[model samples]
Target: MARSVDTRGARPAACGLQGLPGAWRAPFLECAMTLAAPEPATPMSAGLFADEAGCPRCSWCQATPLYRHYHDHEWGFPVVDDRRLFEKLCLEGFQAGLSWLTILNRREGFRAAFARFDAEAIAAFDAQDVERLVQDAAIVRHRGKIESTIHNARRVLALRREFGSLAHYV
Candidate 1:
């Protein structure tokens, strides 16, 4: 006995796989089916709100351009680079009592002060570097957070040696 799949009125656009070659259909469908669908938005749901462009977004990211850009481009995306992973960990530590937006705004400054989050470079940071960073107003001047970042950098090196990369360890 043979069962046939009904293909009546099926449009590729509806499946979001339009313009893909026929060979991709099966794999794409398989992957798509395995992922959970997002919940439908409701008027009472405070989780989502429309931006000025009418695109629905998380409510917290609507306050500024930097937040919106970060939400759209970086948030929720997986990062595999060791430096970026280290940067994220350091920033989250710095964000303990502050808004993420404040960190995002000064991200470039942090990068500059912390040697662009390079684990090897930051791992070498010493007392003089700490003093230099404390006087720098570009990033958070909290000595504890700065020290933690330097300490974490050394850990990152250890993780790299054991796990091959931070992404793999994570």
Candidate 2:
């Protein structure tokens, strides 16, 4: 018979298959395993998981400190700034085949490499800039994505001229 586990409250975050004593880790891992199974025996609600402090959060953000931080601070918040909005557009484009974690981890590098996502500055990027960015290890370094970012920056300028801000454009 399949067993049922109650996952209603906050649980320890040390659910990974590493670093805890066997006795303590076993049950947590079991719970994690149950949640991770391809077809969960029990229906879990809304993908919510409580942190060590007992605050509920999205399940996907429980994997890493960076994800948790992003969940707590940035996720679900409203953004209105044009540059920030444009930055998100470019980042989302870069994130096509990759995980959001990968994009988030390299956000700073992307900012540095892409002129802080300034639409005007990026719209002016030339072939030399594309060559330099294609060799950059910090960002994804896909020539197409780099070129798309530049192209989109120009589009953003057009949108900004028509609509007051990228926020308004969207």
Candidate 3:
């Protein structure tokens, strides 16, 4: 009882970015479209690995130390903390055009640069903050992504007030 998935025009609702304003979400659509497209059919199993690892993981995560550690320690694990959730959101935005490993290596730098991902704090980041972040070497210095983080922080606060928590909202 298997049905095929039509990856074309697939909605990005699953990524939770659908409701965001166009300007806020425009940059992500290309990435979403790329992700939503179906890969060439392969006779492969999704859970191709499991055993002493304690959980089955997607094959892509097997490639590097950072991905493996993230898969085992963080990925797919339930996240309930608001700050961590906010951090992940910003990190994913920063992840555009960059490898996740780059972000992982600079996670602490991001935390420090963004005031530990406090929504209220980030929402209040002035122009000076944006300029400083652009010059920060440890983290990605893309100005647009830095500004998006601040914009998204304000959005997070609104969502939090409406939904009780960003985790709940997400």
Winning model by lDDT: 2
Instruction: Please identify model 2 stretches exceeding 4 Å from their true place.
Output: 1-44
> For each candidate, what is the lDDT?
0.72, 0.74, 0.73
Candidate 2, residue 84: Cα displacement in angstroms equals 0.9
Query: What stretches of model 1 exceed 4 Å from their correct place?
Result: 1-44
Model 3, 30-124: lDDT tens digits are 33322311355333245444323223345777788788767644665456678888999899999999988999999999999999999999999
RMSD of 1: 9.9
Q: Give lDDT for model 1.
A: 0.72
**What's the TM for model 2?**
0.73
The predictions' CA RMSDs to the true structure, in order, are 9.9, 11.2, 11.8
Judge candidate 3 at residue 64 and give its lDDT.
Answer: 88
> What is the descending TM-score order?
1, 2, 3
- Residue 157's C-alpha lDDT in candidate 1? 92
For residues 26-117, what per-residue lDDT tens digits would candidate 1 score against the true structure? 23232221222234422424466544433445688778979877765567655666777889999999999999988998899999999999
Clashes of each: 0, 0, 0
lDDT of 3: 0.73
